[model samples]
Target chain A: MISKINLAFSQCKKENRPALLTYTVAGDNTKKKSLEILNAIAPYVDILEIGIPHNTPVADGGQIQTSAYRAIKNGIKVKDIFKIVKQFKKNNLNKPVILMGYYNTIFQLGERSFLKHCKRSDVDGLIVVDLPWPENKNFANKCKKQSINFIQLLSPTTSDIRMKNIIKDSHDMVYYISMLSTTGGRLKVSAKEILKNYNKIKKINPKQNVVIGFGITEKTISSLTKADGLVVGSALCKTISGALSRGTNPVRTAENMVKKLRSKII
Target chain B: MLKLKKGVLLIDQHDKNYMYGGKFGGNFIPETLKKPIEDLTNLFGRLRYDKNFIKERDYYFKNYVGAPTPFIKLENLTKHLGGAQVYAKVVSKANGGAHKIYNAVVHALICKRAGKKYIVGDTGAGYAGKMLSMAAKKFGLKCKIFMGAKDIKRQKPNCDAMRKNGAEIVPVYSGSQTLVDAVSECMRYWVSNCDTTHMAVGSTVGPNIFIKICAWSTAQISRELIVQLKEEFGGVPKKLKLINCVGGGSSAAGFWNEFIDYNKSQVELIGVEAGGPKNSKLHAAPLTFGSKIGILHGAAQYVIQDKDGQIGETSSISAGLDYPGISPLHCFLKDTKRARYTSASDEEALQAYKLVSKLEDLSPSLEPSHAFAEAIKIAPKLSKDTIICVNSCGDAKKDRAIITKRLGFFR
Candidate 1:
């Protein structure tokens, strides 16, 4: 069976532009508001990257960290994330939904139980930021057996040998961390350097669906149109944070921001 | 070969090819930190066994930090307890008033040799911070420490000691406002400033490479103990019991490292954890009660977390013992039954604190007071001929203010 993640990538290929992947904390501020925000922004983006709002997100920068803190303070639990995904899938949305966060959250719920929850909730993929290659092979295989995509992350620091090993078992897509920094840090490296590394991975597995994330704001999205998808996480979360601080409607604000970012891709 | 069981990677304990047997240690850091951690690991491996590095460390240990701290028998306390013969490894006699100076001195030397301009660390009780500050000053390097706001308030003397030694203290206000938060903040700081700063992790609780490096540096405790036992008892005891209180478990790891290869049935290793106050949500004994294996501070270990996997808030009168996680090495030992894990209540530790101060005329820090409390309980239960060595790793003079406040002396 073709997973919704693969289908989404294939649809993006037909549109002749990089897919727009937007990430938001699964219960940021409030569970109700988080669901509303996800529904509002889903149509404007190709894939919905829902964060599980863990207490420690080591790979994320300040913006995502603050968002996760807010979400956790608002009493977001793991079951609530499954509930939100089930609600989103009940709406018959075609956009693939990926649950992204650290490994401890899923490890707390046994891997098998977590995968069963994902299958029940219709979660298309998982992006456990801390579960790097080789160490993650067994869990990745379990994810594959359940027909859920276990996305692999590639950074500039990933050596050639490690890259070959990681790509060998990587399924659905590969997440290329754009720079040697966290998710929201400044994009200091030029576009040429990013493409240089991106093309290197492509040479290794040209057919693998590769997406670029980190430091991709609306303005920077236009510069990174050469990949299969562009993940805008901290930018969108920062927008929600700013809207909440100003007492504005975060759902409307994030929807407008995603629409504008999507407009920049083409 | 590694096996994944219940989301935990299990490795063979006898695997000498891997450091610490990948079962206990794994690098779960961010991508940006991989290279820096690797660099630190490689530098540690090179410097750890080098002749010049050994000479320099020995010179500093003897002249600067005062190595081979006295291992004296607490004759009065043992007589009063009326049971097993008790001894104390007095690490407080070492420089900076604790055994943590050994690691600080070694890590600072490593950073200085690596050409790093700044050293960063996180501390719970502030002893590590003060020691690192002294090491940084001796090595002529800039130093910064992340301390929890609560710990900064509780450990004011050590905080002042760090500042007096020319180290900047960054108060962390995240995640229960404690040691775990301080560690998280310090790691974020290292991630951003890794080019110029080396993270001198305060304990053997972080990534795999860090644990190995710290274990190497701290092996001095056991190494000295081996010689001291030989001089006093003519040889290592056949029925020996080593006890130490564990927070991040560096002292316990150091004290037990050499003895792990010994016959397990002959030597008994006991690790005491903070049991907090009875009938209160203030305990930090993860190994004693916590069953789930989870990742915290980069390494997979037994973590005291809530049902939803949220890191639990830990509490102890002793700031050093108030942590949500213990070192992964402690977890492995506890899992294999190589060591017995137990807890001492806050009230029990306080009683032991006073008893040791009065009987032995030695004011022990609350961190080691937990170990004393356990010793008081178990020493009486053991045979009179049995030998139990309690690692009195900290001096209670540093906790005078907090102790006075808790005892209501001001009022």
Candidate 2:
């Protein structure tokens, strides 16, 4: 059977527009609005990456950390993120959903059990930022058995030999972290740096679908449209947070940001 | 050509990662207040060894707090035990006797330097709170102390000292209505109104900055011992070990810093916990039984957290000794096998209290009474000449009535 991920990427390549990836922290500020945000953004975006908040997220910057703290203080448990996903499915938002977070949260929730829960929730993929490629093989195999895609992140730091190994071991598309710093750090590094890393990774595995993420915004999406998919985070999450602070509709704010984001890809 | 001071690790003042521990001790407060916490920690770390801090501390140590708090040589107890020649470093002679003064004085001074007019503190010992209030009064800072209503009834005189120092006693009645509750209340107030307000924590529980201060002040015991024994008894003991009961772990950390690199083969260290025939899971024995590597109050340590990720159960004979967890540095020490930890029950500890009062004319904090209980059991196993040291961390004046009420008068 042609896998769903391959099918999605095949459709992405043919469509010529970069896949619109929208990211939101589940239960940030408020839980009810978080669920609303999921359903609201699903139709506008090609994919949704839901953040599972943790107490100590090692590799996040201030904005996302603040969001994570709010989510945690709201009594949002790791299991509750799955509940929100289930609620989104009940609303018939068929957009592919991925759970993205640090490795500790997944390690704390045993790999086998977490994959099973993801499968039960119809969570299409997993993107643990800190888990490197070959070390994730056991978890990747579990996801494969469950037909869940385990995504790997590649950055400017990836060497040619490492890139080859990572692309070979990865079950899904390689998520290319666009910069060296954390998710919301000022993007002082050029898109050329990421495109340079992208070309190197493509040289190793040309057929592997690669998605660009971290600090993806409308202003920078044009430089990264060559990638099979574009994953938006930080900037989009920050936009929704800004709107929520001003008492604007979070769903509408997310939808508007996605529209602006998708326009850049086209 | 110069013989360098050994065992000292030096770092440049400007190194980015120059904190005592990695991110654990780095000042990560908001930028607006970063300078203050950094200044406070740096100033305190410097003052710990500063001649003035020592000179002023010595005065309190002598006449006011009763310094040279005797190192009573437990000759009969040691001979009976046949283990080590145990000596107690008594700190109970101070106006409000306890090693809590060591840190409390520094905390109050930090408040004074920051141009804060009032000092607020939360305490499990009530001694640290009382000491902070007393220090604040002496230093001309108005102070308020938050204590658990349950603790207030248990430790009445310490509560009175808060009022005597013109400190407003805010009784916390939150979950468990104990020291932990009082701390939570105090923290909530501090975070909301971070003005010219300084909050003094009772023990070396929150941050390593507090540990450095407590260790500095209480290290005087080790310094005095080395001098006294060298001058009066010919030379240092062949092997010297320091034992202090671990509550929030200040006394133990203070005592241990002096002998951090003392040849373990020669000298040994022991930390006693409050123990009874209870499930280790439910007991307040962080070193003996805790399995968590989570943050409590502030720093990461072994805490008795329940399955639902809540701070779990704690138990002790004395209100001062009652805490769910201990200092993270002590946790690190315990894990590295640098120090050994054990516990003694109420029955054994009470007996030790009586034995010490009669034999040595010393009344120790109930917390160390637990340590004495353990000493009684193990003393018979050591050589007659092996020296063991114990820190009587505080005064036992408030404990007599509790003893009378519970077990009748000291037989």
Per model, state how many residue pairs clash: 0, 6
* CA lDDT, every model vs. true structure: 0.86, 0.69
Q: Write the per-residue lDDT of candidate 2 for residues A85-138, one digit (tens) a residue.
A: 988888754567888876545644667778778888889888865455554677
- What pairs collide in candidate 1? none
Window of ten residues with lowest summed lDDT in model 1 chain B: B3-12
Q: TM for chain B in all models?
A: 0.94, 0.87
lDDT value, residue A33 of candidate 1: 96
What is the Å distance of residue A216 in model 1 from its true position?
Answer: 2.5
Per-residue CA lDDT of candidate 1, range B1-411, in tens? 332233222222323323244555587777667678778878877886699999999899889889898898999889989899999999888988888998899999998889998999999999989999999999998999999998998899999999999999999877677889888888878876787788988998887777776767777888899899999999988789999999999888888877876666678999999999877976999998865778887878888886778888788988988988988778878777778999998889888887788789577899999999999998887888789999999988778887776664311
RMSD in Å for model 2: 11.2
Tens digit of lDDT per residue, candidate 2, span B177-200? 677667656654453334557777
Q: For residue B107, give model 2's deviation from the true position in Å.
A: 1.9
**Per-residue error at A230 for model 2, in Å?**
29
Give, for candidate 2 chain B, the lowest lDDT window spanning 10 residues.
B9-18
